[model samples]
Target chain A: MAEEECLTELELAIQVLVFNFYKYVPRRSLVRNKISKSSLRKMLQTEFPHMLTDTGNRKAADKLIQNLDANHDGRISFDEYWTLIGGITSPIANLIRQQEQQNSD
Target chain B: MAEEECLTELELAIQVLVFNFYKYVPRRSLVRNKISKSSLRKMLQTEFPHMLTDTGNRKAADKLIQNLDANHDGRISFDEYWTLIGGITSPIANLIRQQEQQNSD
Candidate 1:
């Protein structure tokens, strides 16, 4: 009887995405990068409010915090955080999808 | 203020993984292949019990079904389905990890 103990790479992708999205919040003081924490917060609030649930805003943020605490060091690392917000990898898929949606608008 | 309208590749990866996992389930009759539906059933029941949330065991199975129905076409494609159960791409990682686990056992 063999047990499936490892996560699929897809799960790893999801974990990385979630981690990158929230890596900035608590560690705002540490990561003085090009993207600011306030900017990230605004992006999340406006772009993905569906992620928030029936219990109001706090619970959604709470789940995010738990997911990003991957090392469970009570904090999110810089690498652990950036991959969460990866919306595009290139010039084409990035620009094309947006242009298509805007044309319909 | 630009909004993020597209899912990242990472989300697509998650979608593919969950989709592949359940594609074999409902359309068992159509999928009379090398891997029988019964084997899949045993695998899910044994390998991944953590996926089940246990409302006496029905809701967990229900959630899995919904994820695999990506097109809502009422059928899962062979491509969509196989990618879901991809625990390995064969060879090294597969054999090495298994041997390590067995040695520990």
Candidate 2:
């Protein structure tokens, strides 16, 4: 069976998240699965243009990365990347939900 | 400006994830933002047909939910749901990466 044939929306979303992560990782980087801090900053600027408004703020981005980088490693692991995305997503989700409720009322 | 007009791919992906959660929630559930275990199970079976082969196994689904329900609240909150998605996505990401590497070699 072609796995992609029956993939659902959630699954596709997961793939998009993963593929985006790989897009930020340097091909020649010794650490294959991790994204460096600078790459992460650029990723936020590019991939999260609307959701993360402070991507241009170096200090804010660095502090956000530090919060996500659980091990205090300057780079972001896949888990850390997931956390970052979730952090950004949660508030947006709430805002969207509130807007939806307001519109329905 | 239409916020939807310029949302990047990553932001869209995040919305997909959040909207999928609401898809399974009952309209009149006492809890506004939490997903019941049964709803979560159905979501896994329907949305992750390929990724979660054990969706047919009730015990396994329950156990998975139990692990994700950090507060033992008997329901999956959005944070727990995000964690669950991350858990499933990580291995699949690694597998896809390996496949890509193999194809390029």
Candidate 3:
């Protein structure tokens, strides 16, 4: 019943990540599917405020965006966006595992 | 207040993906951090039932595992695990975007 009416938790989470990328992609851009560096900064600040606080600082955000822009094209493609999310998750994932271990002990 | 008390939505989503990998890793393996093909199949069946129904077919699941095992090690490392999640999300993302556009129209 619930399975038929709604997506699984993992599916919903994946959608959130994907939808966030499209949210900032400019509709009128020639490359409408990708997000520009400036738009990425704004998206990070708004959607991931707690995860990416440095987005408030233009230089810091630019540096971060540059790392995610693998093609050096000044735009974040879906693959680049996925990479950024992976980068953010890796360290936090370790921290979470540590916490879980502590609590289980 | 909420930020201090709990992880942001994106962070929680990331943790779910990470923890799912750890859940299937065998505790007594020489390589505890990575998941074997068998364990990965079990995980896909249990944690991603809707998304990975083909896991019930042993051959299909093994084929999927082979593709995700990037280093030919027969084990799924964190990077490999991330790649699998990315692969699953990409097509669903396009579908979701189409649905959203239709709703807005």
lDDT of candidate 2 over A27-81, digit per residue (tens): 6652377888878878887877656662233444456677766567778878888
- By lDDT, highest first, what's the ranking? 2, 3, 1
* DockQ metric, candidate 3: 0.31
| TM-score (all chains, Cα) for each model | 0.25, 0.83, 0.73
Judging by DockQ, tell me the better candidate of 1 and 3: 3
TM-score of predicted chain B versus true chain B for each candidate:
0.28, 0.77, 0.76
lDDT value for model 2: 0.72
Q: Of the pair 2 and 3, which is ahead by DockQ?
A: 2
Candidate 1 backbone collisions, by pair: A17-A84, A20-A81, A20-A84, A21-A84, B20-B84
What's the ranking of the predictions by DockQ, best on top?
A: 2, 3, 1
**Per-residue lDDT of model 2, residues B82-104, tens digit only:** 98778767766777677667776
Which parts of model 3 have CA positions greater than 4 angstroms off?
Answer: A1-6, A29-31, A52-64, A100-105, B1-5, B28-31, B52-64, B101-105
What DockQ class does candidate 2 belong to?
Answer: medium
Give the worst 10-residue stretch by lDDT in candidate 1 chain A: A85-94
Candidate 3 CAPRI category: acceptable
**lDDT score, candidate 3:** 0.63
Encode model 1's per-residue lDDT on A5-72: one tens digit a residue. 45444334434444344443343333322234444556556544433322144454545545655444
